[model samples]
Target: MKTIFSSLFLAAGANAIITRWAPCCFHLSASGAVTGTVGQLDDGQNRVNGPLSPAEYCIADGAITDANGRGCILTPPTSQWQCDTGATPTSGFSVACDGTVAYNGGTTFYECQTGDNGEANIYLTPGGTNCGEITLKADGCGSCPPPPPPPPTTCPTNLNGNYEFPHLIIPIDSSNPNSAAGTSYFGEVSSTISSIFNFDIPASDSGKTCSLIFLFPLQSQLTTSSFTFSGNGAIDFSLLSGVATVSTSYANAPSVETDYGSITVAPGNSYNVATFACPAGEAVSFELKAVGDTCLNYFQDYNPSPIGVYITTC
Candidate 1:
């Protein structure tokens, strides 16, 4: 026998009862709580006192029924509608008692109040007819969904300003994840942070990256590891122009030195400006671009053809 169940918050009045019409002519094989109201399987099944009521609703299509019998509310095959696992198992739906079926073999309930109260024929309801349908379990009650997941956390970085390009930092935003980015301090990049520097150029990647920072023609620092470079120049605010001469050294060959002349050119297609966040006083977001011989060769690694940059820019 298949069955379904629903929870109803029930409070027994001084004199209250419940009823459900049998689906068809069916026998009431007394098993569970309905034995009292049912009286017997073949004899005294469908009969009620007070307002026919059954708080917790359940279904059990029995093997028998009765035609003229309005007394067959309590039919055979019983099952309990247990509550869902929670402090309260009644959330999304409502509970109702239905007994429209006359006698064939329908649903029923065991209204166990403080009274010697007994069984009653009643199926669980979403509410009105043709509303919804549910399946019943032979073992335990039915099922429902679990709770919901939590919200995501928020973390913002200070990066808001019009930053011109003197360098370009490119990180591989791809499946391989070979993107490169770092902080660049002016002059010889020392261990400690200095304010005399013009601005730091952060690459497209993160972590302690060392690059030459020249505030035009003064101040410098050199941190250990990787290829290191630093130099200085002068930018006349009045003229808005400057020349920067930079020297380079590497961890493999620290003593060797190479010079790279830096200047502002038209925004080349090869160079991509990237933004960085500064967690400090008045927040600052910078888009820095510095493309020179020191970085990767655009023609070989990225574009594959030098003509692309020339033609695209032209």
Candidate 2:
């Protein structure tokens, strides 16, 4: 070691010529553990060789003393080498030293820096200070994995909104005289009516549960709604194509039946009517007709104004 550093002391003013420096070797495992130690070169010298993986630095001065001790002399691949005393590091590198720089006026740790020629270099303590010999050790740190992605959005089993006014309402077929009143039948005269309401399911809400909401003002109501009811018990209805024109009878139009098990024609201020699978898009219509003896009055002189109606989907 003395022969290696002897020629360096003869270089110009404050700098020295560095050669024969041993590499501070390290190995990173597949599991992310880092291990290795300072090693000697073929010529056997105690100097440092590095561009350290996690970065390293010294606490005090960048000079080594003569007495042979492991130094805090570590170099990083980056332009600067920085490592705090006790903080969680992003690169997972840690700092360690054999002894403080001022121990008995002797330096146990020394800092490494880049020379003007871009080689690793260390400064020697001025003539008087003693540099002690010491060994170095450090542990590796691994990074944490990323968090899991959020769960998918799900559809609820029940209806979840108030009666919203539909964009369009058209009267189709009804047994009551006022059924001829067109869209007004829903808000005007007392009638057991057949009508259609806008049911546009958004693409985003496809495959989600959906329902039609209604405001039934007056009643002698049945518990369900269907097209072929046994006599005068339940009101009948069909889902027609959204493009179908208004008609006194749409009996022959291509249609789908409302699930009888899902219909509720009972008297109520608000009711969620689940039609067949109400798929997304504005391609379908709801048409209801009161067959036998059911009186569903949307508006009556004795009752308040009708509450608007709409659909709900999730």
Candidate 3:
């Protein structure tokens, strides 16, 4: 037998009841033959006390049609309908029940209280159909965002900042470029070509603890594993500017060159050679000088550059 159920909520005097209606027309014969018609009511299953009077009525199609046939639905005026529990289910939404419906299905849902009890008998409706009415609201029920990720317990090794390529690379006077065309050669390739890197720090990372990282990839021959030409024992970091020519000697270097200190770099792929406190919103120049006389070069290929420097802040 085929069956359809209809539910309705009713309140009378000081009582509430769940009235369920099942069409009486759906019944199967002993031989398994389908019988009865749609909308037919079985009195035992459909009868319920009417909210209006003392008489009972049959529920059908979610409404009362007559007392014997079916009872008529009582439509109350504004402020006329009163809750038997003395308190309405917030009229629109219940915050305590907001996420309960979302656990079942749908991206959004509306929740409402069923009685003046604890957080029990919560009603859930999916989508925006019942919004702003007596039992649902447009803004009262919205899925809240998940809590943010927890902060890292330990300080990170690398900080976030803006880094740019150096505007100029000046080698010491009398030192010619290495076999690589535009690269600045350092150390005694023939006579000695000590290079100075002048990096332009962006003003965005100002007023923060900053550090400089130098990258030297082995594939680009930026670093020579051979100790003979890997003579970079220590590096000097300074704030330099007014570099008009590549032949500008360090002895007569610009007054803008404020030497930070000499720092040593370990033999590795990258080097965190210097750390400094960033100044105000001004483009500061970072100058680097290798101390030892080893034949090394800062590979200068813009396309997948091999050697570069990064300025980061924390």
Candidate 4:
């Protein structure tokens, strides 16, 4: 005989019943799914079936939402994943898990991380920032030259006077009739006449005396090496300007001698006047020599022998 079965009885005898059952809704209520048990069935025989599974799948559109309930999409499949943050790394530009970010060439910055062995975000300060765009280097410290040496001191000018002696002497030979041969003297006179003259004058006058001034003009600068004075002032004898007469008789012979001569003074470049004398007599000779300015003065004397003569004037 045919009989009706409740939902609970059918569920309990799910494997035993072979007859077709009417379709009913299996509602999933708030309390959850109901548990049932039946004998195990063969793998291919009494089982539910559905469409083949796909290698990749996605949920329905907008199925997963964030905390705000706004739908979010996953990134396309790739070997790596990346994020985009506004801040850049300290080092130069690089590819990382995050988006590309620029880095200052010389600046230093850091990020938050745990251990030590991680990517080092290092950079250098931007070149030429504080100092300005520097292409070449500026000069540095160096040494300078020392100051010049001081000038030299000068020497004091010398102020002194000069003088000379000019005279001639003749020797009487033994054979001369009018001369006492043994008493004749021919050597230089023994006196202090040869002593150097030392005197003083004004610096403006250059120690020059009157005679020198009267001879040369102020323009002529006289020096000890250039000029000197001569005469009795230089010695004991005063040089006289005039003619002289001499008459002599040999003490042991019979001949007599008479002589007349004239003396004259002329301008001298370096000294006072240079004197000249000439005596007149027959067979008599004379020699003239300068005796001043050591550079030009020298002793000279000459005589002609066998003279028996007289002179009216010289």
Candidate 5:
């Protein structure tokens, strides 16, 4: 009887060890398919056994083992869950809430529409799984302003004047061969007339006749009513002849004829009428000739003479 008791005790000890050694924890393959035996449950009721259903499995607890026997961690939504409505997602499609891939449903959340989707992709720093989108704007951020308009151009100033002819003398004489009665006498005659005459007379036969007969070169300074300067530092002025008197006498005869005329002169205002625009620190000279109808007449009818040249300064 003692030997029988010993055998029973040994058998009981062996059964206890077998029951304690059975595994309780379970895992799944990476393909989402169930694999391996489900661990034995300690509960008196036979609640755990066989393959696990999708609804019954807790994703976090499922250990993933790949086909190659590599161990991995199982995550929620083992498969890509597409929307049921068959609506295609446009660029910048996004999810409003954080959830597993299984939560993607046509009715659950909003996504960018295919044709009307207006979004921009953005890159985040430090690297993360979450990528986001931004709204499309008519004008993008930081657009450059248009180039500044070109500077305006400035116009140059014009300095001009009017002139008149009051008198000219061209003497016809056939007297002493060396007589001052010819053109030679007119040079002195012009000087004398300019010193005397001072008045305005209508174009008259007296003025025309004297001019035609005795070619006398006559001129006078013009009085300016106003003078102005341009932006370019040029001066502009208008002048009118006050009056002039000129007379000529033949070298051989005592006969003399007097003539009168008027004229104007305007030098460029930017420079001095007398000096022009001579450079600073430089010795410069200008020869200003009195010009206008009087000068024209002298050049046209009178014998060549030096009386027409005039000079002024700044």
Candidate 6:
């Protein structure tokens, strides 16, 4: 054993070249675990690196007390290394990294950085630090808490506006008089139904009578489902294109517009708009039903009249 150690010392001093000066070998100290880069003497070779801690003689000091030691000195690893003390789950025990830089309670995974080409790797103790959970990359970020829940959903706003329907003919059913039904008699005034509001022409009838043109004042609203509407309409008792001219005072009411009709979603949900058409040879068909609140109110007063302009168009 003495001869072997002597040969180790001789080999380390061979680099000195001048005098037979060998560094003073470490006198085995009592401190069991000395910290810092105090080179380890192991595996049959004399070693020294950036002065792996030498209480007596550092390699920087030019000569050791006993020519370094009889073993290879481990230099801190060459590859860049990092530690990731994985996030400890909220309810579980802390999963930490060990003194060797490996993580606890998980697989030993070490990810390589952007091109770890031509580099040496050692995980034990890179840079003389037990960086647990080693990564070939410098960034040591690890698993994080789960992402926060998504924000709650919210209802969207609707567009409030008006819908205009131009030139629509609405026909009112003339047979259903409120109280007094109409009969064709020479003296008995025929049932006279009148829409006071004039649309461009006046039905100059001696008594208030019905006309063809209609004006629909509509309102629209949006709902959670889709869309809805409400409207009140008046048929113009003015110069209906083909109707006979009657010079009547009721047809001359300044504001002859009557709230006689409404537009609402029909029972089948398809009645979105109130429609009108003057089909050839057929009396203008206009759906002047007492549909909504306003329409029902107006029809109440304008009912059971002595004159029924028996036109099924509102």
Using TM-score as the measure, the top candidate is 3
lDDT of 3 by residue, 170-206 (tens): 5554443332223243322213444555555566756
TM-score leaderboard ranking:
3, 2, 1, 6, 5, 4
lDDT of 5 by residue, 1-314 (tens): 00000111111211111112322122211111111222212211011123322111111111212222222221122211121112221111111122111111211211121121121111111121222222211111112335677532211111122112223322322333232332322221121111111113233322121110111122332222112211221111112122211232222222213212222322221211221221222221111112222221123211222222221111
Top candidate on lDDT is 3
Query: Which residue pairs of candidate 3 clash?
Result: 64-71, 66-70, 66-71, 132-137
The TM-score measured for candidate 6 stands at 0.14
Predicted structure 2: clash tally: 11
Query: What are the per-residue Cα lDDT tens digits for candidate 4 across 93-167?
Result: 211111111121111222211122321111122221111111110011112235566432211111123221112
Candidate 4 clashes: the total is: 4
Model 1 lowest lDDT segment of ten:
305-314
Q: Which regions of candidate 5 are displaced past 4 Å?
A: 1-121, 124-126, 129-147, 153-155, 158-314
Q: Write the per-residue lDDT of candidate 1 for residues 1-314, one digit (tens) a residue.
A: 22232333221322111222432221222233333222222232232222333222233232121232221122123322222211122211211122222212223333333232433332333222222233211211222334455422211111122222233122211222222223232212122211111233334323322222212111121122122333231111111012111221121111112222334322122221121232122211221223332221111111111210100000
For model 6, where is the 10-residue window of minimal lDDT?
87-96
lDDT of 6 by residue, 1-314 (tens): 11111112211211121113432222111111221222222222221223333322212122222233322122224322221122111110111111111122222322221212211222223332322333211111122345677532211111112111112222222453332222211111112432221122223322222223221212122111221223442222232333211221332222312333433322122122222332323222222333223222121111112111222122
TM, every model:
0.17, 0.34, 0.36, 0.13, 0.13, 0.14
Model 1 residue 302 CA deviation in Å:
23
Prediction 3 global C-alpha lDDT: 0.36
* TM-score of model 3 vs. true structure: 0.36
Candidate lDDT (C-alpha), each: 0.23, 0.35, 0.36, 0.19, 0.20, 0.23
Pairing residues by index, what is the TM-score of model 1?
0.17
